[model samples]
Structures are given as structure tokens and as C-alpha cells.
Target: MITDPEIDGDWDTAQGAESPERLTPRERARGGPGVRPWLWALGGLVVASAVWAGGLYAFGDRLSEPTLSYRPSKNLCEDFKARTLSGLTGDLHKQRPMNQESDHPAVYGAVCRLNNVEGMPDFVVAAQVDLHKKTDPSTEFDVPPLADIATIGDVRAEAVSDLGERAVVLTSFGGTEQKLKVLDGGAVFTVQVSVSTYNEKNGRPATDATAVQAAMIEDMRALMAALRK
Candidate 1:
């Protein structure tokens, strides 16, 4: 007969079967599915990393700057034209408004004179805008609305000349860093002449101009031909 069997220890089975071995901590976590579950976990981690990277790229895509628009005004002028050489005689009359004292609603004004007797506005190319009037003539140089009235600059007639019995003159104004010019083709007897350009903003010019100085000059020549009596 065999001795009494030891009951406190593990046992083995017949047919080459043995008791199960104790699993290590890592082995316990990876039991059953072995490396398959670890491979699946790694795949999930890679997919999460890829999604995170994609989101980061999308958020930072718009790193460029935006552009602004600025359209300030500047003046311009033209020199000689067709009716220069003719000789006008006698004193020209000042043209006052028939009914109204001023062109309050008008944006532009260009009237020629045969004489300087009338206390008229001498601005051949004046665009009377609806901004607060800037009365200052020093240092600061900009139109109204953009600048206070006291700091605004000027664009006015700077000189006049009577060449060979002709009332040719040079007009200039300095402000807003722009140089505007007005050319006068003096007086031919009872008819005097002047030309000016409107203020421009941005790249395009004002659709509404106050003085078509050059056009007025041409018209004055035609008028002289008709009124040469």
C-alpha cells in the first residue's frame, strides 16, 4: 500500500496533463488573447494620434494677414489748350447767380470772369463737400471729416500772370501730400480763362467733379468767337 497522499500541494494528472503554473503580473494582463489584444490597443493609439495631428493642422491653417482699404483725395491740373494765342479786349463781367446768392447744393463750381470786381469765390475747382470746414493753413494737411477743422490743410490758387496781354496764371495747392495745379490762359479782351481738376480718392476719381477747368476754357474760347462784337 502507498503512504498517505500530501494534500497541501498542487497535483498532476495522468495522460501528460500538468497543474497550471502561476501567472506573472504581465502575463495575467495578457492572458487569453495573448499579443492580439496588445496589437489592437497599439492600433487604437495610432488612430488617436493621427486624429489629434489632423485637428491641430486644421486649427492652425489660417495664419495669413488681412488687407485694409484706404482712399484719400488729391487734386490735379492741366496747362495750355487750343484758345491760347487769341487776344481778348475790354473788361469782362462777373457772373453772379441769377436768383440764388450761392451754389449751396452744388458739389463743383467753375465760372470764368472778365473782371475781378465781384467778390466771388475764386476757386476754379472747388468741390464743396459736406464735411466740417477746415480753416487752418499751416502744419496739418488733410480734408474735413478725416481731420478736425483746425488741422485741415489747403488747396488754393498760389499765383497769376498776364503773359503778352494774355491772363495766363499758375494755380497750386499743397495738402494731404498731393500737388494740385490749375492753369489759366489769361484774358482775350473781355474773356478770361482757367482750368482745374476734381479731387480723386483711391485709384478711381470722383464721378462728380466741381470744375471741368479744361472744358470751361474751351467753352470760353467758343464764347469769345460768338461775342467778339
Candidate 2:
């Protein structure tokens, strides 16, 4: 049979050889095989991987997206009044209930600040609720820098729990302050409660970090329990 000039052997001899084992080196070297079977297999595997990636890119939204819950309150100040302190009426004590609305209806936030009467301590509670339409399962909730992971019941937080129950605290965004966060449904609620005392002699704000933490924890726990109800 005719064979290509570049090939080392005749096409007939290469094709009709008894077996690969019997073929001479020259015969085995030519009829210039189009491509090896392993090469074909590798190409097929690559094609399959590409198809899988394309499919994922095209239809990923329909797969694995988490459905979140949304809850809105009309009167956040009245709701948090009793939970904050006894005989503390938002109306009676210069209560400032702040409300902010976003373009996305799924996102909602509210804050209620109860100021102290010059000598006593102050209390502020804020809540943010986000109902995400989609969620990344591979994502990680990274703890804030220089913070330790802590737990209150089943809730996890980044906090410092070195002090006794009288003062369990966590540092928050605004420097060293006590804070806590809890995840419910598809919503995350973060609460910060801090106490700052004036140093009569030093003329600067003085704080017992551990004591503040303990008080903040109690307030945070109370606020969380109230929100859940």
C-alpha cells in the first residue's frame, strides 16, 4: 500500500503487523499515527471540564442559593424600652430612635439611643436585618482582626471573655467596646453596649474593660432575647 513520504514504513506493513510486540522499531515509528489514544482521552477530559465550568457559569444562580427571611418592625423604640432599663421611657428621657431606609427593601436597620443623665451610664442598641436573595456556601464569616472567637449559649461572637460573669465583653469596630452578633434565619443581628465613666481626677473617660464587658453582655443577651420574641 502507498505510504506518506514522511513515514518510516509502508502503510500496509504497519497496519498488517502481527502485533505491536512483533513490529520493528522502524515499523512502529511510522505510518505516522494521527494521534495517540491517550491524547484523545486527555482532550475529551478537557472538553468535559470546560463544559462543566460553562454550565456552572450559566446556571449557577438556580443552584444552592440560600433563601433568607425578612422581618420589619414599626416601633423599635417602644419594643426596646423595657429590655433596656426599668422605668426608662423613650419619651420621658430624650429617646432618639433613628430610622434609615435603603433602595433595597430587603435591607432594614434601626437604632434606639437612651442617653444618661450626666452622672449615670448610657445605653445604645442598634439592629440591622438583611434578607439575602442568594448566598455563597463556600464563603467564610471572617472574625474581625485582633478579636477572639467566643460563644454565648449557641451564639458565636468575636470577643474577650477573660472576666467573670459580672463582665463578659467583646471589642467592636469603635475601638475597645463590648459587642455581640447572632445569626437567625437569613438575618444577622449585631448588638453593642458600652459604658464610659468620667475620671473626676484625670478629666478623661475611664472604663473598667471587664466590668463594661460584663454589663454589655447582659444588655446584649437581653436585647437578643427581646428581638427573638
Which has the greatest lDDT? 2
Steric clash count of candidate 2: 2
Q: Residue by residue across 1-229, what tens digits does model 1's lDDT show?
A: 8999786424432233221365566666655223457787899999999999998876543322211111111210111112321112111222232111122322112232222124432222211111112221111212222332234343343222322122222222322222222212211211123222234322223322223333334433444343222
Q: How does candidate 1 fare on TM-score? A: 0.20
Measured with C-alpha atoms, the lDDT of residue 55 in candidate 2 is 94
TM, every model: 0.20, 0.51
Candidate 1 displacement at residue 133 in angstroms: 42
Q: RMSD in Å for candidate 2, one decimal?
A: 8.9
Alpha carbon lDDT at 205, candidate 1: 36
lDDT to native, each model: 0.29, 0.46
Q: What local lDDT does model 2 show for residue 5?
A: 75
Q: Model 2, range 61-148, lDDT digits (tens) per residue? A: 5445554443454555554543433222122245445544343543455555554333454444444433334553223323442333
The stretch of ten residues in a row with the least summed lDDT in candidate 1 is 69-78
